[model samples]
Target: MAKADNIFNIRGRLGDFIFCQRNGKTYVKRYSGGFTKAATQNHPNIKVGQERFAQVSRYVKSLKQQLQPYLWRQKDGTFHNQLMATFLQIAKNETEKTFNELIHELDSYSSLSNKSLNKNSKIDPSTLLYDAKTNKLNLGIIPYELAVKYKGLFLEVATGWYGVNDGEIFLTESNRQYVKLDGQTKNEDQLVDFAPADDLDGQLPFVGLAVVYTDDATSESPHPVHTVMACFVETRNG
Candidate 1:
């Protein structure tokens, strides 16, 4: 007997058309008519052919409804369920804390006067001095997350050095580039500042505080590079 064709090539149509393969021979069953078996006697391995048919039938049943319109535009219910499941999993692992709770412990320290320099002082004297100079005091430590959420309030208080433009809060051109204020190009430095404008709402312009650091050197050389911290001292606008 001649060898049969592979069963993989047999295709099925929608509605009531049935397709099957035995050995290498193809067969079909139509809804309106009787079944038609292959003429060739070349039979495929019965076990493998039955398994292949079952697998294909399972795949076809799993497919979406054929007559549906714009399949891609429709929300996949299965996919949405999967996404929600993943979100719940993430929420379970995360720690939930209120902004006030996170920074409340630092409130006492943040309100202290910057003068009378003492280890027991609740606040840094320099910060108090700056507040006095600017006529503004650090209310408290803003939770990092809350600060980001209410960034508009902070931006209102910031100087023009920071502002939201084109959907991002960025430093102005004057402060855009990192400066080696301490004269160490190899080290890193950044400056940011912000203060409220004259408007009654007290919106702040973006300002950056400058950061300065020295690079680690291979030799134990005393590179006494220090950025003048005084530059950060707040000044009242005329």
Candidate 2:
């Protein structure tokens, strides 16, 4: 069905039709009927009035479209996140904390790319060994999984549209390209010789780690002063 375009401004509703005002004239009519003069009599029955108001509320809400909000923070100390801090009323100075920490908590970090590596040579998944030699933090072999659900979309790798021949998997919808595993063919028999492993950026297929330090920003730090705040296999891309 095609959507109707009407210039009448909806004010409320009557029994079987909506109350609206056109160019300097008040009228009432259901969406499919012709406009007529609005009824001025008050609904004497309170129960009937409540039901009518409820119907009008649902109809009016259906016409609106909402947009998603994008939230982000700039630096550690600066209060640059106006979208959530002021508009959403989620941010308030109740505690003395840094802005960097606040935004990470609010926006929820997103991951980009992930890869599987040698499992035999991986470090402990629950431990973050700070390499004094390298001065960097690194993680090892992490397990991951990917689940795809298609309700009603005609899609398959190495196939084309109906009654057509295209020997490629179309890269649409988020450009999510799937690479065939080693020595695996594209469309032969649709049998599973091997499956591609999904990336583990921040989708949280498993728990991750968080670390904090109380250093004085000095060159030489003391022992036990370097304590682990949090430890897991999480890594953020963004």
Candidate 3:
């Protein structure tokens, strides 16, 4: 590095040299172009960092895509970065835990619990129950207040499953079920069901919920959509 005596007083990168002012005096130095892929891949420390980053990115991308339908309107921009950092920490430090374990623990360890489709809505969201024996996920009843609030409109409830072993999502048309929300009823007792294929056996299951009002609803209000992460189940084998 050397003092910059040029009249231009350049304060940015110019070719291989970088000019900047420090302590009211301009200085110039050779710009570091950063490490090459070969250099980073060969370096022991950098290589480990690279591997961890790749693993984290792969898992994060898959999960975000699976949850995008429900989280499209979320305003928090840093959630993804926060989740990535969390996963990266696990990837680097928790060598014994499998990738599926990370997915299973997402609701507790990551920012998933904070995400909601309709934050200001008055209606309460339904809960979920998973059955390991039947490979089915059950959606609990939606309160009658939801029906009265929505003017007797049906609730469109959908379930999604994420298989960490294959990095695939198993949400299909057959997985969607509608629950009638008649204002007269005390509660909607019909249990919504989602069944995953047998091929998903022995894979980690991460389930989520997406609920919205039908288009024909006569309610004049905010029409809340409830999207939630139900549970992450252990890898089960038949």
Using lDDT as the measure, which candidate wins? Answer: 3
Candidates 1 and 2 compared: the better one by TM-score is 1
Provide the TM-score for each candidate, comma-separated. 0.19, 0.18, 0.49
lDDT of 3 by residue, 1-238 (tens): 9997766767988999989998878999999898878876799877666666776788778756666543443344565785686667666566666555555553434333223323432334434455566656544444355555555455554454544345443333224456655644554344445556554544334443323555332222232233222334333233
Q: lDDT of model 3 at residue 105?
A: 51
Q: Clashes in each model (backbone N, CA, C under 3 Å)?
A: 33, 1, 0
TM-score for candidate 2, please give it. Answer: 0.18
Compose the digit string of candidate 2's lDDT tens values, residues 1-238: 2222556555665565666655555666575654343332343454444444443343223211110000010121222232222312222242243333332341322221121111121213442222223322333211110011111211111110111013211111111112222232223222211112132221222211111122112112111111111111233223
Ranking of models by lDDT: 3, 1, 2
Best model number under TM-score: 3
Q: Which portions of model 3 show Cα errors greater than 4 Å?
A: 1-47, 68-79, 96-127, 133-136, 141-154, 164-174, 181-190, 204-206, 215-238
Better of 2 and 3 by TM-score: 3
Q: What is the RMSD, in Å, between candidate 3 and the native fold over all Cα?
A: 7.6
